[model samples]
Target: MKTAIIYMTKHGTTEKIAELLKSKLEPGQTQIFNLKKSKLIELDNYETIIIGGSIHVGSIPKKL
Candidate 1:
């Protein structure tokens, strides 16, 4: 199955976690996107979507 790991990180921690998760999944079947850098992401193409973001205080980032 195709997987998309979309994430937003403040201090790069969330990006690291997303990469780790991708490593555990099937090779070349997973793709990662950073919300801060990516302008347009076609999420409809992915079968499984995993969203991750760094928590600050009590909530996630507004961009997320």
Candidate 2:
């Protein structure tokens, strides 16, 4: 299976979590994208996708 981890982090906590997940998952075609610097990616190519975000001051980022 193919997987993509797309994440946006204000303080990088979410990015770390994404990395940990990637490390624990079974080996396969996997990619990670940081929303802050990545252009629109073809998420359709991935059969499974994970999105990560964080809350700050009781509010989540608009990108999430």
Which candidate should be chosen as best, given lDDT against the real structure?
Answer: 1
State, as a TM-score between 0 and 1, how close model 1 is to the true structure. Answer: 0.95
* Candidate 1 Cα outliers beyond 4 Å, as residue runs: none
Ten residues in a row with the worst lDDT in model 1?
54-63
Q: Against the true structure, what is each candidate's TM-score?
A: 0.95, 0.87
Those runs of model 2 whose alpha carbons end farther than 4 Å from true positions after fitting are none
lDDT of 2 by residue, 1-64 (tens): 8899999998878989999989988787788899998989998899999988887889878976
Question: TM-score winner among the candidates?
Answer: 1
User: 5-49, model 1: which lDDT tens digit per residue?
Assistant: 999998999999999999999999999999989999998899999
12 Cα displacement, candidate 2 (Å): 1.3
Clashing pairs in model 1, backbone N/Cα/C closer than 3 A? none
lDDT of 2: 0.88
| Model 2 vs. true fold: TM | 0.87
